[model samples]
Target: MPPCQSSQSFALDAIDSLVRCGVLITEENPEAAPVCDFWKKKGSLKWTTTDDPYHSDSDCEEQDLCSYKISQPSRCPDMLFFLCSMLAGHLRTLCWATMALDLMNTPLAEAEFVRQIHSHLWNTANQKKQYYESCSEEAAHTAVRTLIDLGVLLEERQTGGVFLGVSPLFQLSENRQKLHYFITQYLYS
Candidate 1:
């Protein structure tokens, strides 16, 4: 099977198992709504009125699941750049991510870095009412965590202090320029 198809099948099976095991309550379940919404937005799941509730067939024509495929070792930076571009589509996330990148050169403590990003997001949300109203500190934390999970950010603890920096995987000048362009186009424009 194609990689994307296999990924879709695996996701469907996992969701089915979760639902069957009562781990995920679909009906009137507030917690599951976000999970469902995310999958639906990603075109991995669909809701059908006539069929058996949720449909497994995804119509995500623009969804390129193969973007993460690294056919050559030299293409790693390209993959990371693609991932960042995807995240740039979400304004609030782009703000948090780019703010992290901006502060990468500063020798601030980890907690201070997170605090600064949260403050920046909160202030921006206040100024831009139409974009987002739920840019809470928790959201900032989640964005930072996501960057870390994606290997775009790194955290190290030493006797001097806790250091946070962009991962070496994304430290290339070309990648930095592309990321800055994304910030300008998506966040400012």
Candidate 2:
């Protein structure tokens, strides 16, 4: 039987191979245009350039990229957790309003849920004067769709109507606590 490799190790190996092939250029590669562009756009990838001059060129004053260190696996958060946290940050009002509804205990009709989010945003904007006008119904719909895409919310259809509730992923106590923390921190702080 083939050796069983953990997903993390497998992913790291694949990334290393890409890096070797110049497909996933690290900050260290001499030709790092793509990585530099990515850094400029996202500023998410960590990199550092050393002051030491390149051995091949004496006239060019560019710092050496070879010394840059790759980000360690231990320092990286789980992808799903990171995505959820980012989503909560981006949709703070929607996340807060949804959690306030306590969807786990009482699922709401889809329209009612969207209405609640719209109303919450309207009231919040009015109180904070954060916006000249209230958020539109389309924005509320998009937020709901995003939540569904992230598996944070689930949709169900009964004979009477379609209802929305917290997904099984968030129904777990641990996940629920983490999500609650993110939502509250983003919305209140």
In order, candidate lDDTs are 0.54, 0.54
Weakest ten-residue segment in model 1 by summed lDDT: 63-72
Clashes of each: 0, 0
Pairs with steric clashes in candidate 2 = none
Per-residue CA lDDT of model 1 for 1-189, tens digit only, reads 456566546655665554554443444333333221333443544432222555435444442221111132342535534654555435555555565565456445778777877777776766776545436667777777766654456788889788767766457655555554544653433
For model 2, residues 1-189, the per-residue Cα lDDT tens digits are 227875434544555564554343455456543321233233332233223344222244444444222332343535435554555434665554555445335478899888877777666667777642336667678767767654567899998699888775556655655655645553323
Of the candidates shown, which would achieve the greatest lDDT relative to the real structure?
Answer: 2
For model 2, the stretches where C-alpha displacement exceeds 4 angstroms are 1-90, 93-95, 103-105, 132-134, 172-177, 180-189
What lDDT does candidate 2 reach at residue 34?
31
Clashes of 2: 0
Tell me how far the alpha carbon of residue 187 in candidate 1 is from the true structure, in angstroms, after superposition.
Answer: 11
